[model samples]
Target: MALVNQTGSVFWSSNKSTTVVNTVAQLLDNGNFVLRPENDENPEKYIWQSFDHPTDTLLPEMKLVWDLKSGINRFLRSWKTNDDPATGDYAYKLDNRGFPELVIFNNETIHWRAGPWNGKRFSGVPQMKGVGIMRFELQENSDEISYSFEMLNTSLYSRLVINSSGIMQRFVWVEGAKFWNQYWYFPGDKCDNFGECGPFGICNANPAQMCNCTIGFRPKNQQAWDLRDPSDGCVRSSKLDCGSDRFLPFKNMKLPESSKAFVDQTMNLSVCGEICKKNCSCVAYANMKITQGGSGCVMWGGDLIDMRQYDDSEDGGQDLHVRVAASDLGMFSIAYE
Candidate 1:
């Protein structure tokens, strides 16, 4: 039998090859709504489920992914309005152009970026580090890259979502209050907006001004910069010389946009730097995995984009080394060894 309600019948299945039989769909107390064989109660045998087609909420063990060949994905789209269940202006999606990064798009433009993953969590979203109750996992394979989280205690309830206003959030159910309390949310400040400081710019909300160009960079449009509009981004203060360029190390930084980076899972950090120094097109490089003492490398060949400064006192940051002009390295009083 199909599921019917006052609104009408809603059949939940992403696979067209599925056939309906004597099965029952049950919404478990753990927030999982599953459809399984009528005679088989074990969840591992579930043939179809609403959890797989999550509209806006991400329950425990649910995943957000990007696939190149199959194009199958489970992402969140904002509701059109507070009163409607229609598609809206923003979409929370995982982009795998080069490496994988979680991005929120408004119409076809990037509105917010969670930054690329650095093994443990999204490079920019230090807050995503699961607390005592929640545990997180990220997996990248030959076919796809995905992120998911599980509850350390199955009895507790937690959910993540891309809300209508283009913000990503996580909420936890408070049993006594019988409500979901906001655990955290993203795009929390002006600096959190996608590319807020523009190319080669690093944003820090705590600073008097959130925007500043990185070493060896200058405003692309000084006129627009004076008007407080940095969308024009930045330009390198000097041209890169592949033969003698030096790397400026920034600790506890959210790495630049990765869609244009060259990713290789086999190279170590030393080899990554050597290879990057040999490529005149390369601008920056960083380890892909922070765990296991680091494992992969992503070398950005295009203009570095969407970088931000994180409060190092908090937690979870990556080390990024960007190729710089020899004179610029001298500005920091460091030898270009």
Candidate 2:
């Protein structure tokens, strides 16, 4: 029997001969299935390669590639349940927003975002630091965008899996303990909730003030904001003169959602800011580098989304320069400094 859906299709076979085999061997070490010719060394060139066909787990050395020209992307789809291998509602893919970024989806809705790749890790995932047992990479070109990881030290076995609850987790295999140790998981807290604070609003889940508007901006609905409904977001306090507007530097912050931004790989931060200022729609700008001594720039032209304040001591976050009325600059200058 076969069932077809808008985004995916499924097929099933009842015959035992067609589905099962007696000589097949499954290896847990490499997650590969192979069939051998009695005494052959290479196992008949792999009857089934798990790398070609993936479920919800992404193992080391396996590539998650996308072809922009063909509109084809390869990524992990969560299983319906622990017992069922059927595709679930959640999916993980590299999204071509303003810049190429990693996004998790629950059906058509965005479940969470990893922000854009800033020459290191995703801007939103600052905790993915330190010399780990695995090294991750985000590759992008005119043809495609792909996410892959490699084992830095072979002795330390690590794996990334999308669980039934829609959380992506990294686990390390402990040989001595004979169990998997949890390393990290996505959606760390309320701040990790996708677009929780709505457009132009920033969320700092574990902060004295969890949600607030950016500098030079004010809550669109003060009543709604007091009631903990930040969906109204923030709006500019005063109109930008466009001629005298200057970018107010905001240091030690996580960049806003990239989807609303305009990006140019060739431009530096200063030039990018100038380009944004010239346009009345430009709201903010940030460097593309995710490390110390950052370079390049990503500029936002619309409302900022999915922004949060992060603990700089735990993760190396970036700074953002937000546009403001030149007259209002003096009022907020001390706070920014």
Candidate 3:
């Protein structure tokens, strides 16, 4: 009824008194490690398992929960050192503030984030698309808000790790190579850094000057922007005229952070536009699910932050509609019709 730590201490325990004569701990074929009586061979018949108590690594079918009312959260904290299993400063937690987003924190500061999950996938993690390895899902209902994934190909092995340095990385085990090969990592470059370009600004890793204001937007602080410091973000060139305001179709973009997002899952893309138009605070909107002709809506109520251009030929790009005045749109003005 207890799980031992590396320090030979009882780190966690069920505290259930048992008087079983013979018991055994077994690692099942489905990657579930369970504890059961020696006579019981089925995992469903087991009592405790390693999947229920996760450490730094997340395996297939394992869930990460962030409940609102109950305050029962299951998250991962990095080891104190590379070889030490003790707690560290870096942590990965499910932030359910506005919408649900997975964020890595260095102590208490936001170090990196896998942007909010649309009905399909996380906006910042498009690499999972067409991978043919995992089937990921995001569940948010009245009871609880959680993120979980299962392997599409049962033979394949993969994991997500929050390293000691506060980097979130995904790796696949290559049997022939007999090693774990990492294909993706968060904070991969300057662009992945939380709000590198501030708000209403795009971070392009390929560009010599990584940070640039979005179309119809100007630097909030021109002096700082001219000095190669764009932390002040951007400001709209023209004010929205409510009914007449048009949406600028921003393509191949990582959707902005959703802390100030107004999400309505029942609304279609057209209805989303109508509602956004009615609300003066709504600055932008996007289709949460880009697959199957697109569905659902995500509306940004305030300043949009942490948006960037993705390089994935087709899978990674999203069409974001930014509210703009008719006059500033130029040729794009006529296309709004």
For model 1, the local distance difference test gives 0.81
Residue by residue across 157-206, what tens digits does model 2's lDDT show?
A: 88888877789998889899999998889978877889888877878766
Global lDDT of each model?
Answer: 0.81, 0.75, 0.82
What residue pairs clash in candidate 2, if any at all? Answer: none
Best by lDDT: 3
Residue pairs with backbone overlap in model 3: none
Per-residue error for 168 in candidate 2, Å, reads: 1.0
Q: What is the TM-score of each candidate against the true structure?
A: 0.91, 0.84, 0.89
Name the runs in model 2 displaced over 4 angstroms. Answer: 1-29, 32-48, 331-337
Better of 2 and 3 by lDDT: 3
Residues 49-81 of candidate 1 have per-residue lDDT tens digits of 776676877888878876656988878888887
Q: Which regions of candidate 1 fall more than 4 Å away from where they truly are?
A: 4-21, 42-44, 67-69, 331-337
For model 1, the run of ten residues with the poorest summed lDDT: 11-20
- For model 3, where is the 10-residue window of minimal lDDT? 309-318
Q: How good is model 1 by TM-score?
A: 0.91
